[model samples]
Target: MADLSTLARPYARAAFDYANENGAVDEWENFLFIAGAIVNDKAFRTWLENPAVTAEHKSAALVDLYDSQVAGDNDSAFKQLLGENKGSRYGNSISYPKVSPALNNFIKQLAEQERLALLPEVYEHYRHHKAVSLKQLDAYVTSAYPLTDDQRQMIQTRLAASLNASVVIHESVDPSLLAGATIKVGDKIIDDSMRGKLQQLKTQLTA
Candidate 1:
């Protein structure tokens, strides 16, 4: 894990910088989204795992798959970069985006050395990077009590105002919450529930 973090840091930072410079954060996000999906696919994952297939073939396959997805300059650059990377390190868990030849070389060194799978952690860290740049917060709301659309909107609006960022929300019913609602915005929490209230009281009494 330490090794994976070490490998992922520079790559993630480079991608973040590129996205910021080019104002292509959304584009990069989409590309990463698609590429990650492809890499995670059973067939594609198998192909990447197979040592027999040359790196060129894998790179070609990806380029063909994403032929019209990105602009011409980006398409060529990324394809060549990833192709070389896949070839150099035939198999090992990795998650760094192939930003360019230089970065790809760095990742190849990491992969060939068999550091560890860094993709999941990289994605998590990158999400935070993106969120900060985009000024967006993702919230997961679980409620024991049902919420009306108006109520949800009010809460979201308040949260957005307080955080000074846009909000993306997902809602679910959690009977175990016992009452009120629990909202998680990034690493922050706003828990307003009977269970939470009880815990507060218990803590105060013990203290």
Candidate 2:
């Protein structure tokens, strides 16, 4: 099979373009994140894999799930003001009509194409596109130990400067790294760890 990212490209590009054009990129990101998570659920995945389940039914289920989650916040807010029963009833009735239409259509489009399994990939690709368009990067750093505040700041600054984009660092400690760290952003990696150096030296010696 083709790579999942390859399959996700067109849809991700389309959604990103639409969202970017409408100044709704962030909003769409939030929507995609939620939708992706829902589709990624074990229960949902099982149902999704059932050949007997119609696409329209899957689409409706996704739409309903998305709608209920949004409305749930409203339900809570209403409950705080008007008490439980009345609030929940009112909130449940109050569909995110304006928001729902766009999402409903998007989900329906995916279903029509039998491509709903692509949501998680779509979201990931969409997020990557978003980051590029916004001049932001998500960087992962694995080190031998926790990064101090100064170390974190220095890494963030250097990465931002080197990449020419705003950088957000996610740190993990892997003692096996022995020393130093590896930074990953998108498809790029900067490996400066003792483990990496040893491996490179071993490869050269073997060669």
Candidate 3:
């Protein structure tokens, strides 16, 4: 497997710069979303990898697709720039070069090595890196009922005390949880939910 973080570093830095320079964080966000969609599409992936298709053709197709979906002031110019450079030699390359030349060159190097297929993983790592850089923690908490502000604040305080860092919580109501709350901080889950408690009881009974 590719070292996904290494693959994503340049791209992430490029995106950060692009978003910073243009004050277009929203644009970069949309751009990455579009790039991810294109990378994940089977037909697009095949076209990018197909040796029979000329680079020019693939590039043109990408330009059309991106121009239509990635709505922004400089989007058309971005597409034109991509078309001029020729489509990436790598099959997994994401055309998010609107913000940074260094990012474009980095991905181009990956393309030459035919490592473009790792773009999805790279993107994942990129998000994590960006989150860390911004001092933000991405977390999801699932609960059977909506947590009151007091309850949420208590949990946040506990998490901060335990993890030694403040967290911005993303909470969701999942009636399927039955009752109680399940807190997830990064990859760690504190499953205080009724479902989890029952499962533990069941396991212990069987044991």
Candidate 3 structure quality by residue, lDDT tens digits, 1-207: 547657766766666665667665544544454565566789879877988866555544544555564333444544554343333332223444343443444445555565555566555655665566566575578999999999888888877777666577887999988999898877788899999999999999999
Instruction: Report the Cα RMSD per candidate.
Output: 9.7, 7.5, 9.0
Candidate 2 per-residue C-alpha lDDT over 33-152 given as tens digits, one digit per residue, 9 for 90 to 100 = 666877888998899989899889989887676555554565543233222322234444443332446667777899888889899899989988988888999999999999999999
Model 3: residues >4 Å from true position, as ranges? 1-30, 54-68, 71-97, 147-154, 198-207
TM agreement with the true structure for every prediction? 0.66, 0.78, 0.61
Better of 2 and 3 by lDDT: 2
Show the colliding residue pairs in model 1: none
Candidate 1 lDDT for residue 101: 48
- Candidate 1 lDDT over 2-54, as tens digits, reads 56566666656776676678675654554444455566667777767777866
What is the C-alpha local distance difference test score of candidate 3?
0.62
Ranking by TM-score: 2, 1, 3
Q: What is the C-alpha lDDT of each candidate?
A: 0.62, 0.78, 0.62
**Pairs in steric clash, model 2:** none
